[model samples]
Target: MRMPAAKKVKSLPPADVEAIFARFHEIEPEPKGELDYVNAFTLLVAVVLSAQATDAGVNKATKRLFQLAPSPAAMAALGVEGIEAEIKTIGLFRNKAKNVFALSQQLLERHGGEVPADRGSLEALPGVGRKTANVVLNIWFKQPTIAVDTHLFRVGNRTGLAVADNPLAVEQILLKVVPERFMLHAHHWLILHGRYICKARRPECWRCPIREWCRYEPKTPAPNGA
Candidate 1:
């Protein structure tokens, strides 16, 4: 297989960009994040723990964890040690536990145990960053913000949707190009597509719904041409 192109096309044409998302919407009309959360506060914590971890992994760890402490007050009661014990199965659980505990305290002390809708407020919480805040805002608050993770970064470049050197640049280009109607679920669509189809190694380009508009070169052939 050929190596991924070192250079990236700036972006697809507006029509192609529109069609790409249209295809995504058609394939999965109601795309959703894989993480399980009962409410905005739980969703916020789940996104924070998802750093460098798979959604499935985070979900598994958070299931009982959330059931035990579903709110900020309940989470704060867990303390760092208790939180760590529950999520130890995940990577960097100690640090994640500390962050969760601290953020839970902050939520209680600052926001009265409610998750904030504003980006700055959300990012101010412990363990929360731009990407995490964006995810929370997009998913829980119904904002049109795009959170650029590794998958989105790769897909944006490989598909010529919004190639850039870093996630922030890709996010900016996507914000400007992705249709307003699609912006709400754009990140989820791209993420699921990258995770299941346009993977980093051995992308399933043969069955990609948007292969016609995708600029990824040397598309992977189907097994024995099917």
Candidate 2:
């Protein structure tokens, strides 16, 4: 069946945007990404494996995998078969295994076994796209970048924080609208908010902290017997 087009989100004014982000910061001063990793290399691997997978799923597999191969050299030594076996539970495991191994090799050969801080260098790695690179840069390197994942895209557009058609546009709009103090943690806040509250199918709007600031009409009511 053909789905209805997404509602055109009305843009929030600067003051409203600031207030919304201010609330996010006040509630969770230092929001963090759910994906678990030890260091930059592990973080890269985790993000790569999280393409069509959940953070909890990636963490579940990587708990042992990271212990087995914590470094690029170690992961390279583990080989594609080993990586595949470890991450087989995740979606696109075969390709993700190939990428993990190949990127590990590249890290050793070109980067001296270190994840590069530069966006171009990070994106050059296998399976590391703009989103992955942005995540690594923001989380590991403390860069104020918005990694426009499904959660962030939905939250940004739905709440009028950013009214964009694509992830890239949403990211760009958020970068401009979000205050500098909140930029570093903005993506995480939005991600967690969307994942738990502003859900795709049925957002729990009744108890939302930022409901007053949201542009989404027809706010969902409390579930029966709640």
Candidate 3:
């Protein structure tokens, strides 16, 4: 559902972005990724499935599938057909299934069935992109990497905190502007905020925590028809 449109978040200067991060650290302290997974391998798979899909959707699909194929060996054993049957509901399920199976085999052969911690190795795997690699690096390895997905792209652009055209540009801007202390949890905070509050549709300004810092158009009507 589209949220009520929010006023543009105030364009944050570099110092202002730093200050905002400081406040976020005080409030949430330790934000984490919303996608649920049992291990690094599972996290990687879940992220691959999450492209153009919601974490909730990926989690739902993985909840049962992961239990069945928790490891690379197990997933490879399942084969493409088995994996496809399991994840058929997700968009581009056929291709994703193929990638999942191929990646599982590659994992076993290349990394002893373990999900590699390094971004380069992770990117070498099928279906894993920079965003997926960044997510795995950040959530599983606790690296301070930003994975700018659509939510983040919108949040960054709409808020004017880190305006950019593509995810890569946004990622670069965020890395530069977001405070060091808030780097680890920055993805979660921005994603959650974008998902629930600063949505693409109308934003819910009344309950917004950072509405005061925003620069978008107000959702509420003026007191008088001026």
Candidate 4:
């Protein structure tokens, strides 16, 4: 796809971007992370289930799973078959069930059934990737880590905030550009913005707050044909 021209406007300097984030904080000061979970263990399970699935879908599945098996020991004992039965509605339920069981086993053997705060340890678990590790680290441990999912990557590139090919590169650029004060909440702000407003196929730019800062061209809706 041809890259759209970013609308020409006064560039947002680092300080201006920081101010935007501050305003974001004021607007949604305690913007909670989307994925639902009760604790670290449950959080890990929820994130694993979230892959290739919507947060609403994952939450629907986990709402029952957590009630029955909230802890690693409880989950491990529940076994893959039992977990699969509960999460069958979610996408890739079988594979996710296997990974969740394996992750619980690793937690028991290595970290005494507690989710490790370290990125390396978290990623070492079955089905846990860099994005998952970043989410766990940032949300559970309060570390400043950005998990660049599709929404984030698109927003970063579309807004000319941090363009890159892959999530890792986008994440690195975001770390470098976003102010430290905004680092923790930046991921949520961007993700929420992209999901609700700056959608993939047809962005709802009319109600977008940062429309002026966007770099994308053809801002107005195009004719259905041609």
Across 125-210, the per-residue lDDT of candidate 1 in tens digits comes to: 88899999999999989999999888888899999998888778889999999999999999999998989998888889989999
TM-score to native of every candidate shown: 0.96, 0.97, 0.89, 0.91
Sort by lDDT, best first. Answer: 2, 1, 4, 3
lDDT of 4 by residue, 186-222 (tens): 9988889889989888887776777767766668564
Tens digit per residue, CA lDDT, model 2, 92-206: 9999999999999999999999899999999999999999999999999999999988888888878999887788888899999899988999999999999999999999999
Give the clashing residue pairs of candidate 1, or none.
none
Candidate 4, TM-score vs. the true structure?
A: 0.91
Model 1, C-alpha of 146: deviation from truth (Å): 0.4
Clashes of each: 0, 0, 13, 1
Best by TM-score: 2
lDDT of 1: 0.91
Q: Where does candidate 4 stray beyond 4 Å?
A: 1-12, 221-226
| Model 1 stretches with alpha carbons more than 4 Å out | 1-6
Residue range with the least summed lDDT across 10 consecutive positions in model 4: 1-10
Error of 4 at 186 (Å): 0.7
